[model samples]
Target: ELSMSGGALRTFSRCVTCLARIGSDLVFQAYPDKLELHTLNSSRSAFASVSLTRDFFDHFHLPADAYADAAPSSTPLQCSVLLKSVLAVLRTPTSAIDRLNASLPNPQASKLEFVIHCVSGRKKTHRISCSAESDVQTLALDRNGFPSRLAIRPRDLTRLLSNFQSSLQELTVIATEPAARLPGVDDGTGGKAVELLSYIDPTKDDYDSRLHTQLWIDPAEEFLEYEHAGDPVDVTFGVKELKGIFNIL
Candidate 1:
């Protein structure tokens, strides 16, 4: 059982909405110190997780018997629920919500209960059915493993992407040294910059006619932290996933 109020409740709502946009299923892992929510895209190529410490909740509890039979290395109590169903219960505006209390009677329980307290002194209850047999998926990538890293505000990146067509599906990011010149830009200044481009297959019949867009970004000014220790690299990924993550920010 756990209760969240004020800013914590608001954060929880935003996290759920983000997860809903990423996948069809929401996985919940409850531990003694924190609560974690995760989701994996249908293709299993993308995974996202949000962890909230005990301090984030107004009240949190874990029964001693929740995992009594498990070894010390056993996993936490985990369950999966339909993202749409969870979203339905959390769709209420955060301003109208004063508090949210969630409870799972036991590991064998088939339903998760949520009680919402509104500022008007009104209470609303919702029960979302969940399954405990669903397989858990996790990723083990290390952040330090990447030779290049950049930290930029979400709004900054989102504004840059706005230049592309709304229907654009993929985006390519090219990182290069300060002396390296980008495709179209001929500015002589040897300044560090990152290139963002809308990508479509070159072999497509309408390739030449399709809109081509690119944006040059000065990393020194836009990124809070930028580091590249290897050769130039370009990565392409779905823009829809990025928009989903930016929405929460």
Candidate 2:
């Protein structure tokens, strides 16, 4: 059993919904201190995770008492649900929700329930069927190994993307010490990607439009939030998935 504030639920739902856009299944793993939802793209090129601690919720309960010998935090109760089903429940307007309760009587049960407690005491329980297949394993990002990194605010991204043409599906991240490419590797798209990076070279006029956030990170300075060691790296992703992620942010 679990109860989270309406705001927390909305935030969690939005984040998870975005993750769902990148993958088909949402894997929820609960520990004593936190809950985590992990998802990975089919190509395994893109992955995102949301971790919420007990402090993030008003109340959190784990049925560990039912099993005397069961390991607590070490043994996480995990279950996978279809992305669309989860998204459907989250699509409801947040103003109507006051709190949320999620539970799994049996970790191996075929379904899980999410009860939305509304401000007016009107509640709705959504039963989402659990998947029998094992959850997809995600690749651990080696931040220390990535040579290049970029930081931008959500609002900045939203504004920048607003200028994007509808026909643009993929964007290239061009990095450079001497002219590099973003998504340095190929994504599924066959056409050249629309350049989404311009901060690598400060001399370029488009640099401001691309990295207008003014939060660019250089290899010389140690980034407290991120660790990297290598050469400039570029990556690509679908704009649709990016938009979903941005919306959650």
Candidate 2 Cα lDDT to native: 0.68
Residue runs of model 1 more than 4 Å from their true location after superposition? 64-74, 119-122, 132-136, 177-189
Error of 1 at 28 (Å): 1.6
lDDT, residue 134, model 2: 42
Report the number of clashing residue pairs per model: 0, 5
TM-scores of all models?
Answer: 0.82, 0.68
The Cα error of candidate 1 at residue 58, in Å, is 1.1
lDDT of 2 at 229: 35
Q: lDDT per prediction?
A: 0.83, 0.68
Summarize candidate 1's per-residue lDDT along 1-249 as a digit string, tens digits: 999888888888889999878888888888888888988888775677888988989999988888788842356887788889888888778899888999988888899888989999999999989854444445455889887799989988877888999999999998877655666785744474688889999999999999999887788888888887668888988888878977895
Runs of candidate 2 with Cα error greater than 4 angstroms are: 65-75, 134-150, 159-166, 174-227
Candidate 1 lDDT score at position 230: 68
Model 2 residue pairs with clashes? 173-182, 183-234, 183-235, 183-236, 184-234
Which 10 consecutive positions of candidate 1 have the poorest summed lDDT? 131-140
